[model samples]
Each structure stands twice: as structure tokens, then as C-alpha cells.
Target: MIKDRQLYKLILSILTVIVVAMIGLQLVSSWTQPQAQSQLNLYESDLLLQASTWQETNDAEPGTSPLLENLWGDSDPVQQALKNYQKIKTSATLQSGPTDDPEKRAASEAFVNELDLRLGLLYARSGQVEDAIATWTPLAEAAPSPGNQRAVTAAILQGLWSDPPQLKPQAQQQLESQLKGWFRYQSLSQLYQLQQRQETLTTLRSQEHAAAEKALTRLAAVQVFPAIGGLTGVGILIFWLIQFAVKKRQSLPEAASTAPTIEPIEAQADQTPNTPQELAATVRWPVTTIWQVMVVWFAAFFCVSFVLPVVLYVAGAKPETFGARGQAYLALIQYSLLMGVGFSILYLSLKPFLSQPLKWLPLRWQGSWFSWGLSGYLAALPLVIVISVLNQKLLQNQGGGNPLLEIILNSHDRFSMGLLLFMVAVLAPLFEEILFRGFFLTSLTRYLPMWSAIGLSGLVFAIAHLNLSDILPLTVLGCMLGFVYTRSQNLLASMLLHGLWNSGSFIGLIILGSSVS
Candidate 1:
């Protein structure tokens, strides 16, 4: 009894360690995020105030204050502030820095362009409209981000139209350039917006199609129907475990948990139980061959779930015609039904054929409900943040991460947020945990060292998320989940942990939105 208890305790402790490590990783990642914008913000604010002060007076004589006099001399404070702003402007010129990551380099160029826009805004406000227009003209050309270019060009045009005719001919031409630029800029902006909308519609349609196909596939693929199969499988496992426990009690003079002088008869019997390895032997065959039954069911499920929708999509069915609310309900029903079918098939097919008793599937309570859910969630939160930072900094810095995809996918709009929430807080953790912690870790541990199993599973999980940019973070998360699952031999525990990690991300998104304003 003591030895068995010790072994269980050891497993629990290891699981605890894995959870703690993951949390620590998250905290560290959150701590290391750069505050570049925040650091520059105050300086920019002070500069803006100085410019405002300068613009307040256009006098040639220096002010009475020594600091203002020394800084502006006999020149107007507004002109001097503008000159200083121009100097900052020159320093802010877009330049290729030491970066292998094309995305990061592109981000840097965008940042420089933004600085130029800021300078232009100040110049325009201070009545240097021509100068402001001139400055913004190159930026609109250089970066050419539809959104930014539109804003800058609009500002430029406003400055140009607001300017007096006394401004030089060159300034007048610059104003004309701004006008000409608007023609190309407006068209490009509209085109980009249209393309974005079309892409979103396409993705939504594909997701709906996939969901429908999956639902139908579930219905058809059954070797055995899900509802009955799962219950029966669970019942059978419970029956076997009870029989084993009973037999052991009858034959043994003492408890199985206790160290006995002799091996129990039931234990000895169970070591060579009357369980067949083959499906044929396991399920009395001939009338219902397992393989044939499974294949037919799967084919039916696939045809209904996958093939039909694909055919419809290929035939040019318009999902929008169905309405968004209707489509959402359809998707929900399809997913829920598919899940039910999967669970049913899983319980019946795999559990029934396996030689081991079903004691493993029982929902063993770990701690208080709150502790189990909330503490586990708290433990997993750091893992998400860590993975994100590592993906951004390490993989991204090396010029290997998919920055452009990140930028496009990460647009802070409704569709982008929805997808981001779904990917990070839903699809990723669920599918990833099942593959790495549940499947790969289980298989690897059967043949290799525990650490090796954990490490390999983590690596596979990272790669599967599909971008080199995510490698570091996903791998780390994978390792954490694998280790926790392996150590506890509790798939439920890790699943909870993974779910909590995703929830934390969802919460973080909320926090991020709140912070942005």
C-alpha cells in the first residue's frame, strides 16, 4: 500500500513540476517584451509641446528666457522647432538594418515612415504646409501601405489646399504632386480593401464547407454507432476491472496495494487474461467484420461530410446567400454532431478491443473543482505568453519567421480578431494537445526515454503549427504538455491545462483591446 501510494505521489509531483515550469516560461516571456513605443512616446510629446510653443510666436528677436533665447536665438521659435523636427526627420529616414528577417526589416521601414508622417503632421500644423506635403510625398511612395498611404496623402492634400499662393513654384508643384498621388492612392486603397473582404469571405466559406463535411463523415464512418458503443465500452471496462478486483480479493489473503508474501491468484490470472489481440477474435466475426463495417461507415460519413460540400463549393454555392446567423448555426450543429460521433466511435472501436481494463477512463477527481480548473489555468497561462514571445523574438529575429503572414493575419479588425481567437485559443491548443500530449507522447514513452518522448513530441507540435516563426514557443508548450501528461498518466489533466492556456489567451486579447485605446 505504501509503495503504490509513493509511486502515485511521485507521478503527481512530476506533473506539478511540468505545470510550474510552463507557468515560469510564460512569466519570463511577458517580462521581456520591448517597450519601444512607450519609451519614445514621452519624448515625442515633449517635442510636440516645444513645437506648439515655438508656433505661438513668429518674432525674429530671441525671448527673454535664457533657455528659449539660446535655443531659438534671433530666429522664430516655431521655425527653430520645425528645424529640430526636420533634424529628427532626417535621422528617422528608412534604412535597412542588420536583420535577416524580412518581416522585421519591413516593420522597421514602416516605423520610419510613421515617424516621417508624424514630422509632416507637425510641419503642416505650424503653417509649413508645403514642407509637410513634400515630406509626406516620398513616404507615400516608399512604404505604400494602403491604409498609411491614404492617411498621409490625405494629410498632404489638406496641407496643399490650405497653403497660400505666395509659396514658391516648387512648393506649388509639390502640392500638384500630392493631388496626382491621390488618384493612384485612392484606387489602390479601394482595391486592397476589396481584396481583403473577398479573402475573408472565401475563408469563411471554406470553414463552413469543412465543418459540414466533417459532420456527415462522422455519421457514415461508424463501425459501430457512437451512443451505444461508448456506453457499452465503458460498461465492459468497468465489469472487467470489478472482476479482476474481486478475483484478486478471493484468492489473495491481503490487499493488492499491500506488499504480500505471495502473488495473488487473480493477478496471476489477469497476466494471461482471456483477451484476444485481433479484432476478429475480439468481436465474434463473420456477420460483422470490423474492418468492412468501419470502412463502409467511414465512407458514408466522408461522402456526406466532406465530398458533398466540396462539390457544392466547386459548383459555386454562395454561403452569404444563406445569411451569417444561419451559417453560424449550421456550423455549430455540424461540429457538435461530429464531436459526438467521434467520441462514440472512439469509445467503441479502440476501448473494446484493447486488453487493458477501462479503469483508466474514469474521471478521477484531483483537487477542489476551483483548484483543478483555475489553478491549472493559472499554471498554463505563462506557457502561452512564453511561446508567443519566443516565436516573435528568437525565430523572428533570425529572419526565419513569417512576419508578413503575421502582419496580414494580425490586422486588428473584427475578422482578424475572430480568427486569431479561434486559432490561438481554440484550434491550436485542442488539436495540438491531442497530437503531442495524448498521441505522440503516449507512443514515444512506450519505446524511448521519458525526456526524449517529451522533447520529440514538443518539436513535432511546434512544426505542425506551420511557421518557422512559431517554432520556439509551440515547441516549448508541446514539451510542457507532453511532460505533464506523461508524468500524470492523466490525459484529462493535460487537456484541462491546455484548455486553460487557451482561455488565458482569450482573456489576454480582451485586455489588449482595452489597453489599445
Candidate 2:
């Protein structure tokens, strides 16, 4: 028994060392990598700032912007800006367009327009009047809305009428004719209208900044309040533990004196069991045996869930087909198969070890199970919200979110939506609860303390999702599920709670996606 205990300790120590080493390696790797901005898509403001910096530097130094010097040594700022503009334009064309969401397309268009305007200004500053006119003319023609057209026109006129007269007489005449053709009736009135439009845009931008600041302030409050609440709870727990320990020390003498002494024969009979059944009841089974079940479970999980998906991916089963809907459907099918195969393997492997597998798993429905599940669902809702908010904040701090989840969420078609709903709200709850709580947690309880089993299972469940950003929140959710299963001894309870949590997330995502669009 001592040897077995020592072996377990050694294994644990080895695992701890391995985990620490991996974390250290990851930190080192991350430290060595160059840091970049978190936002996947650059905003118009970012480009505008860059453009303004270039303009300021060029204006101060005649022909030498630091940006141009750094990017293209000794090259003209106008040519460097044009090259940058072309690169941005090409990237924007490839990455975004009519097929993208409305918000994304709008942002892309705004960036492109800003880039064009900047390029036009750079050309005008360099005395390339023809190039400046050529740059702005297409933008004016391509502007979808009257407001956008007016903005473009205003930029064009601003460039044309700027100090030192950038335009040659012939090009100025051509541009004026084009402007007349565009406005049709009164050029002066149209120019005034354009100026007013620009003012309105500036006002709108100011309002947007104000709204963004308000939203950020609210988000900060949300993050702060939860942390404060958590700290208060911890403080209360620590206080209670200290008081309990003090009280226990004070009562130790009384407890010793009051404790009854047992007779030798009575003690021997109590300690020694007469039958195998009695001995089995007295002796606690070691939790290490549960590893057998885990080995089988993981083997099945890896083969079906990991290996199969990789094979399919290699075999030209692209996720982005059918407007990225195919990938969601594929994931649904993959998870469904994984659950089916994994459970079947687990059942086969565990069947020989237990006479009543279902009873052992405690899968039977119990009284008040609905109430337990409903309560769990209700409790989990706010936790999910809090954790989601924190997760987003963490992602912002880390400069990215879960890439896999991002891909799934980015799919907007009906098929993808339906498939994602099934994957999250139905299959995920059913299969995940079955594997994590029904099988793994139940197996773990045979050897470990109940809380230890719950925690280990929750940790495994969180890790199974393969998203570091989601680990904390998912672990919390998994522990909640474990608690529900442990209390009710009915898998349905946890499944119900899981489904409710997932459905809420699905609804929230739908709302968020719609709002963004």
C-alpha cells in the first residue's frame, strides 16, 4: 500500500513538472514572438492616423517623411504612400467584399476610401496633379451613397484648392467639368453641401467616440464588480475558516476528555471484518483503476474526434464550402460520431467491471431532477454571462480569441446556423455530459474524493475544448455540471443545464451577430 501511494505521488510529481515545463516553454515562445495588434481588421482611424503622420512629416521636411525613409529609403513620400495604398487595396479586395457581413464590408469600404483620400493628398502634395485627379475621380464615381459621394467630392475639391495649386490648368479644367457634370445645376451650392456633409460626418464621429467610451466604461464596471464580489466571498471564507480553526483548538481538550475509550476486544472486532463483503465495505478502492476507463475513453476520443477530422481535412473536406456552412455541419457530424463511438467503447470496456452499468453510472432519472436542473440552469446563466464578459476582456488583453470558435461564429448562412445550434445546444450537451459527467466523473468517484473527482473531470472537460481563453469559464461550467450530476445522480439534470447554457449563448451570439451586421 505504501509503495502504491509512493508511486502515485511520484507520478503526480512528474506530471506537475511536465506541466510547469510546458507552461515555461509556452511563455518563452510567446515572449520571443513579435507582438501585434489584437484587432484582426484595421479600423479607418488607424489608417487615418498613419496618413496624418506621413502628411505632417512630409510637410515639415519637404520630401522626407520618416515613414517613407523607413519603408523605402530615399523614395518620395507620394510614391511610398501610393505603394502602401495599392497593397492595402489588394489585401482589402482579397479579404473582404460583397460576400462579407454588412458591418465588415462597411468598415472595409471606409478603410479603402480613407486610403484613397490619403493617396490623393500625397499625390497633390508631390505636385502630381494628374495622379491626384485620377485617384479621386474613381472614388467619386464608385461612392454608393450620396453622402459618400459628397464626402469624396469634398476631398477632391480640398486637394485641388490646397496651397501652391497642385493641379495644372488643363487637369483643373477637366476636373471642374467632371464636377459640373456630377452636380448638374449649381456647383457653388453643391460644394457648400459637400462642406456641410463633411461637418455632419465629423459630428457623427464625435458621437461615435462618446458612445464607445460609455460602452467601455460600462464594460469596466461589469468586470470590476464581479472581481470585487469574488474577493469578498474569498475573504468571508478565510474569516470563517480562521474562526472555525480557533474554535476547534479551544474545544480540543473537551473533545479528548469526552471521547469514549473502546475495550480491546470490541475494538478488534470492529477493526477486523468477518467476511469478504464486510472487508470490501470497509476498504476504500484506489482511484488508479479509473485510469483503465480513461485510457479506453481517450483512445476512442482521439481516433474518432481528432484523427478522423484530420483525415477528412486532408482528404479535401473543406470547412469553408457552402459558404462556411459545410464546416459546421461536418463538426456536428464529427461530434455525433465521436460521442456514439466513444460511449459504445466505454460501455463495452466498463461492462465487465460492473454488473449494473446504468446503475453504476447513476443514469436513471430521479425525483426533483427537473427542479435540480432548472435551478442549475438558472444559476449558470449569470455565471455564463459574467464569464463570457471576462473572457472577452481576456481575449482583448491577449490580442485574440479562440480561432476555432471564431471560424464557427463567422459562418452566417442558415445551414451553418442550424448546424451550430445542434452542435452547441443539443449534441454538445448530450455527448459532453455523457462523457465528462456520466462516464468520467462517475468512474473518478470510485477512487478519489468526490470534490477531487468533480474538479479533475471539470479540468479534463475544459481542456478537451482546446481553447485557453475558454478554460476558466468552461471549467466553472463543467464543475457546475458535475455538481448537478453528483447531487441528482441523474445525467439528464446536467444535460438539461448544459443545453440551457448553450442555448442562451446561441441566442446571445445571434443577437450580437445581428447587431454587428
Residue-level error in angstroms, candidate 1, position 383: 6.1
- Stretches of candidate 1 off by over 4 Å are 1-135, 139-153, 157-312, 315-352, 355-362, 367-390, 397-435, 513-517
- RMSD, one per candidate, in order: 20.0, 15.0
lDDT of each candidate versus the true structure: 0.44, 0.53
**Residue 275 local lDDT, model 2:** 24
Query: How high is the lDDT of residue 92 in model 2?
Result: 50
Residue-by-residue lDDT tens digits, candidate 2, 1-517:
9999888767755655655455444444343211122222222222222333333322356444443333334654345545655665665555454654687678667757656655565565567767766777777677556456545454555544455433333333333444321121122323334446667444444444443333333323333443454555456446545876978742111111111131123222223223222222222223443554555555555557557658877997755453566667666777788777877766666566454444444455546668767676665555655776686465443322333344444556777788888788888888888778876775555445566767899988876654455566778788878877776757788998899777765654443333221
Query: Against the true structure, whose lDDT is highest?
Result: 2
| Decoy 2 TM-score against native | 0.50
Return model 1's CA RMSD, one decimal. 20.0
Clashing pairs in 2: 287-447
lDDT of 1 by residue, 428-502 (tens): 455445544544454343344456657887876665433444566767766766645543445566666677666
Candidate 2 local lDDT, residue 187: 27
